[model samples]
Target: MWYVIQTQTGGEEELVGLIGKIISKEYYEECFCMNRECVRKTEKGQEIFLRPLFPAYIFVVTDHPKRLFLQLKRVPRLTRLLSDQEDSFFSVSEEEQIFLENVQNEEHIVQRSLVEVDDEGMIVKAYGPVGRYRNAIVRQRLRKRYVCIEQDFWGKKRKIYLGIRLREDGKG
Candidate 1:
């Protein structure tokens, strides 16, 4: 089962990590992961760096929803788990959970470029999350010219870095 646990602003990943540890201590055969971007300082000064494919959220897999909730409630920084009736827990689709996991575990390239796909199926270097659900390339900075994009699945968007593979026409 999957549940959306609401956490305090900017503490989503931390709360998720805490949940993972607590579950492990209890010997619960469950797993949890939060999609977060890692930012670092380089010769180019400070960069916004990577964006968590899915920020402010974490996907957890478990069988005992009640027990999970009970355990999760004690975790600090977590506001509450999103439920349907404020009592009934909400579960996420397996496919969606897996997708989140993949993004959390994959390696991506960091380019000063963004991915742009137009109505003509043309992919170009554009700026910002412009398309529906902010999937389009977002121009973050103009001076250093840094572009970042997170992969989008319909209405849901996740942080995804630029790909290294160039298109046949030298575009990505």
Candidate 2:
């Protein structure tokens, strides 16, 4: 089962570091604080930096969400588990889970999608993380800066926004 934990927005990295001490690695397969590279234009210049995909939320994939939750509930900076009315354990919709799984590669880095646009500036297709779901793209940001995709998680449909860079000339 997987569970979502709400932690300090800018402190996820530190929270992970703190949790790493008392918990056993066997308790979970992943502790994901997903981030991706983003470019924003400033008066000075275009700045490139990593932005958290799911801010303040850490997703844990484990066979034992309850165990993991209980083990870390009181840990510093971790707020609460995203729970439902019934169970202490809550899982993301399957669709969302699938998307999350696909978002990250082996090193747990979310792929930075590269989009191809025709001379008319329309999105021809997307490469990288969204390569397989080109047709599923809901909105390709103006100038192909990002893409909004629809996904279903735990049966709820969601719109996910991902950053993309336009492909350079002569690049595949």
Candidate 3:
């Protein structure tokens, strides 16, 4: 199961750094923080940066949430595990889970997609996670180099932007 853990908004990296030191060995290797590569505009030029895909949340894929939580509960900066009941946890909706899996490449890094749009401004083809949901794309930002995909997650329409080729020229 994939579990979401709540942590201080800007402190996810710090908390994740302590995982292996505090959590049980069985769960430590399975915990991860989700992030994505996106383009950012700077004074000099555009640069690529890695930012959290989901803010304030870190995902851990382990069957032992409670067992894992017991050891992690006291860690500083951690808020709580997303759960509805005591000692029990529920996973993100199936679709969201699948999205996470699809974004990751062979090395387990979430790859930044490179996409090309026609002169008419329609997405022609993409290579990476963004490609998988071309049909769901609702917005495109050539300046920012990301595409917004709106889809159903837990019965609600959640719109998220994934990083991609951020310009009309599709060049860095």
Candidate 3 global lDDT:
0.74
Number of backbone collisions per candidate = 10, 5, 1
Report the lDDT tens digits of candidate 1 across residue range 67-144.
777777676654566676755777776665555444334332123334344555444544322222234444343323
Q: Write the per-residue lDDT of candidate 2 for residues 67-149, one digit (tens) a residue.
A: 77777865766467778763556787676677777887765556567777788877787787778677778887755367877
Residue 27 lDDT in candidate 1 = 28
RMSD of each: 6.9, 2.8, 2.4
TM-score-wise, the better of 1 and 2 is 2
lDDT of each: 0.49, 0.72, 0.74
Off by over 4 Å in 2: 41-47, 169-172
TM-score, each model?
0.53, 0.81, 0.85
Clashing pairs for predicted structure model 1, backbone only? 37-52, 53-158, 53-159, 127-137, 127-138, 127-139, 128-137, 128-138, 128-139, 129-138
Give model 3's TM-score versus the native structure. 0.85
